[model samples]
Target chain A: MEFLSYTFMRRALLAGNMVGVIAPLVGVFLNLRRLSLIGHTLSHVALAGVALGLFLGFFPVYTAIIVSILAALAIEKLRRDYRDYAELSLAIILAAGLGLATILISASRQSAGIHSYLFGSISLVGTRDIYMILPLALVIIAVILKYYYGFFYLAFNENEAWLAGVPVRTLNVVFMVIVSVTVALAIRVVGTLLIASLITIPVAAGMQVAWSFKSTIWLSLFFSLTAVNLGLILSFYYNLAPGGTIILAGVVILLLVLLVKKIWLLLRRDL
Target chain B: MSFLKVEGVSFAYRKERVVDDVNLELKQGDFAAFIGPNGSGKSTLLKLILGYLTPTRGEITLKGQPVAEIMDWTRVGYISQQVKDFNQSFPATVREIVGSNLYSKMGLVKFLNQELEKKIYRALELVEMEDLINRKIGNLSGGQQQRVFIARLMVNDPELILLDEPLAGVDIRAQDDFYRIIGNINQEMNKTVIMVSHDIQVISKHANKIVCFEDGRAYPHCSQEFSYDDYIHDLRRTNLRIIPRHDH
Candidate 1:
């Protein structure tokens, strides 16, 4: 109970739940567009940005946001340049990001913090981290809601969206920018390694029974928040790593949902 | 003035011209069907009219305004033949799919008002899909999905509707239903329709104008003015009989 009152624990919870909500929200669109791997690639780029920022003495999260946005634009350019080989863009950038991160981590004497960036430590989240993450989560949520119809159209059928005069090129750039921002903020809470799990696991679970697009989105957010909250509380009491615990919680819930759906189908058959 | 015009239009992929120096004109209420063998650039020409591809040589105009300068895109609706290209597992309801039409024409600011909701219902009613608004799009049959797409295109009330092989994979009964709906749109609603189809007999039965493409060149003819036998012979002679030429 005392741990709940601690500022570090409170901050971690706030940041975790925010990422919990925003990751899956953006993730639903990414999954629909078949761009889930881009999230993993951009997180590696964010890791490189964090290492570079720590080495050069800049705010790591903000530097990550800039680096991620640049990397996203490069990915977009490469995708255009090699339309048939779009996945190659993710592969190339991921390799470069890991190489740069390794070099920067070796150069910096304050490399102890790099451990937190890799696996994530709730104790590492501070007041400054809260301030940075809050605004980004809000902005992403706002944009997703405001341009909900346009983004849905783009995800469903990009060519049709273009024919409808939906400014597809500009909207695509905006979507990547949102992804970059989410990746930057999420790494601070979930770490670079497990961030993809947080983004996609809940979405996968929600998709098991969600019959409509709107329900899928809402159910994904519900599953995400449930996982994060349960994971945070259990980890605090059991002395387990929050990031892995949160992801595992999401996985457990997904398995349970699948089991329940199967049972329901069998019961209906008997009736 | 013509409702839509494509003049001296040409498109190429690295020096191999697909659509070459094509000219076409459509007026309000015109039911024009573009017929060609595979690689004859029928779909390419339709893309040019929708501004999906810019012609390498000449220009296209909509209502006396250049295609590039037209701000009122709601005046045109395009249904691509790439319906099979859509992800089958994508989650959306019929209402959501139909509602997406408002985004391109209305932009980001206007929220879904009562007027837009009513418009969507009216469009779905036109396609006779008003009852399935809440059904999952993926669960629907192919014909039903195609009708939903038509409703999606109609939500904006466009004057010129361009469809590329809309009935390609649909069953014969559904194809008949589609032709009837399109015919009603042209004759009753007085909207111009330019459809690309390989089903020569069905299209010739309904279309007032028939345009044939051969060797990257387009030959437009009034349905009453051209000889079907000559066209079939021309199509067979060029080794362009990919889809089995329909004979009268």
Candidate 2:
């Protein structure tokens, strides 16, 4: 309770909670499309953006969002070009992002400045981050709700969805943008390396017990929120890294869900 | 104008022309099966109609407008070749797959109403899949999975249905059920269909006409006019083999 009174803790918790809800919400579609690594790739791109922003003496978050969205679009384009090698397209972007980030990081010589973005620091999440994260989270939630069916269809099959007039091209672009925005905002909470887990691991857990697409969405949301909040609270008490805690929580939950599913199947077999 | 028309359409992939000066016409409720040996471009023709690949020359119009510009996509349902490579562990249920196709109509509003639910059920019932509506689509047999997709198509009640090798990987036993459902869609629902199949012999039973592609040229004939010897001769003339469906 006393920890909640700290300004930095409050900001970190607020921003982290929003990400907990929306990142996994978006990840369900990403997992279906098998673009789960885009979060990690774009987080690396955001690091480069942060480096550029600091070099130019501008706000890093703004550049991070812009750069991430651009990279997301590039990933989408490359994906279409290499339709058969969709994962190869991601690997290309990841390599490019890492190379660019490494170069820019060394050029700026702001080694210490980049530390918080790499693995996350709750004390570094400012009031501005909360304000930005909160509204973006709400907008993403609303948009996802509005276009839920279209996303599911596209995720299931892109070419069929296009012919059926799901605005496949537009929706694909929009979804990539949404994912990039979420990743950019989430980096502050879970850091560049761990945000991918925030988006994917809860989804992995949800699929273990899901009966349908709707159930998968609900179950993933539940596990995601649980992991992020629990991770944040534990990090606060133990003075541990928030990003590590959130990701570890997600991994643990996925394993537990898998174990439970195994036990339940065994029980059914015995019965 | 016909229900669907492919007028002077020709398409090329990079250096090679895949579809050449192919023209086709279908009235409402006509079942035309595209049959040909491998590399003859039957699937390419289907792609043209779906506007997945635009013609390098000429036009493809559905209901009088270019297919790419057709405003009401719900009027057309498609089961693509990718259905063969379907992710068997996909976590969606039959109901979601069927109902999600009606998304264009459910625009702006987020929830599915009673009417929408009824349509989904009716679609499932038409495919004899209503009992398994809540079942995960991945858990269904190949034939049942095909029916679920058909039900997904039927939910929109589209006028024109395009199926490109819908039974490509389906077990031989389940294939009979697949044809029965397609038969119902054609006869009872009176929907126009364009199906690409390797077995001209089997599909000729259902198709009113057979459009055979030989060396990028299309030859349309009445189903009764099709001869096995003629088809084999056409393949020989083009220096092509009588390709089995699985031979790429």
Candidate 3:
């Protein structure tokens, strides 16, 4: 309760929850599409973008969004060209992003700010950060609502969607753009290093018990909100890293769900 | 006029031409089966017709309209060779899987209506899977999963159904049932079906027309007797009366 007295704590909770919702929402598709690594890879691209922003003396978030989008497009191209070894494309981009980020960080000598972003500093969520996240969350929700079924169709079977005249290529491009924006928005709260876990952990928890696609999505939201809210409060009291704590919270929930499922199965077998 | 026509169509993956100058025609209600050895382009031809792959040097038309130009894909349903390639751990119920057929027909902007829900059940009923609509798709047997996909295809009332190795992983008993269901869809529903299968004997039992693919060119097999030189050559080696191409 004392933690809520501070304005930074409240802002951190708000921004963290926003990332919580959007990251897992996007993560469900990423995990289903077997592109969970894309989040990790793009976050690295976001780092390079941040470093570039510092070098150019501008806002890092905008630059991160631009760089991540371009990197995402490049990843898509590479995936098409090397369909057999698509993961290699992610590895390539990740390497390029790391190299660029390292060079930029050394050249700029902005070590403190970069370190804060690399591991995340929830205490630093300002008014501008909240403003950026709110609209991002809404846009993500709206896009998901508009393309939910089409996305579901593509995830289940891409060729079927194509044959049915679904605008697959266009949808894929839209989806990649959303992913780019998501990576940019998410790095603000979770940090670039922990972005993958923030995106995937909640969705992984949901998959443990969800029986249907709709339920899985809803459950992912539930897990994400719960983890983010709980993690924020816990971190405030314990002086812990918010991003890592949130991920740990999600992991705890997943393990609990799996244990319950196992116990239920064992009891049923015994009966 | 043929409902679907392929004229002088050739497809190549880079420099390797999989299909070469193939010509074929299908009327409104065709139970046409494509058979060949592995890598012989039967599936590739199906993809070319479905507009999933473009031919390097020819044209494919569905209902006299070029496949590339046809915008309304609700008329066509495809169950690809990778039908079973999805993550079995994916959390989707049979009803949800069947309902996805209506996604393209209804567009993504609209919510699922009661009418679409009723249509989903109707499609499930066609495959006698109404009871399992609530079941997790991954929990079902291979044959059941295949039927659910068939129901998914049927939900939109597609006039042309394309199946690639629909029975590739099913048990023998289930395969027979699948063939019957497909045959019924072709005969009773008056739907045009183009199927790719390596099981020539089973396909021959049900299909009205069989096209054997050899080295990118399609050779028609209208007779019950094995007459093609490749077929005769295979027959000699196997010493069996009915040896499927890939099996031989």
The most accurate candidate by DockQ is 2
Model 3 clash pairs? none
Q: Score the docking of each candidate (DockQ).
A: 0.58, 0.63, 0.59
Predicted chain A of model 2: TM-score relative to the true chain A? 0.96
Cα lDDT tens digits for candidate 2, A107-163: 885566788888888899988888888999999999899889989888888767765
Task: Give the winner by DockQ: 1 or 2.
Answer: 2
Error of 3 at A5 (Å): 3.0
Q: Pick the candidate with the highest lDDT.
A: 1
When 1 and 2 are scored with TM-score, the better candidate is: 1
What ordering of candidates by DockQ runs from best to worst? 2, 3, 1
The C-alpha interface RMSD of every prediction is 1.9, 1.4, 1.7
Clashes of 3: 0
Residues B1-248, candidate 3: write the lDDT tens digits.
Answer: 88999999999898999999999999988889997666678899988887778899999998889998867677788888788888798899998888877876575473477888999999999988999989999999999999999998898898899999888778888898798888889999999999997677678888888988767889776455444566555545545454345643
lDDT string, candidate 1, A176-223, tens digits: 999988988988777899888888899999988888889999999999
Estimate the overall C-alpha local distance difference test score of candidate 2.
Answer: 0.86
Residue B157, candidate 3: alpha-carbon lDDT: 93
Better of 2 and 3 by TM-score: 3
**Candidate 3 chain B: 10-residue stretch with minimal lDDT:** B239-248
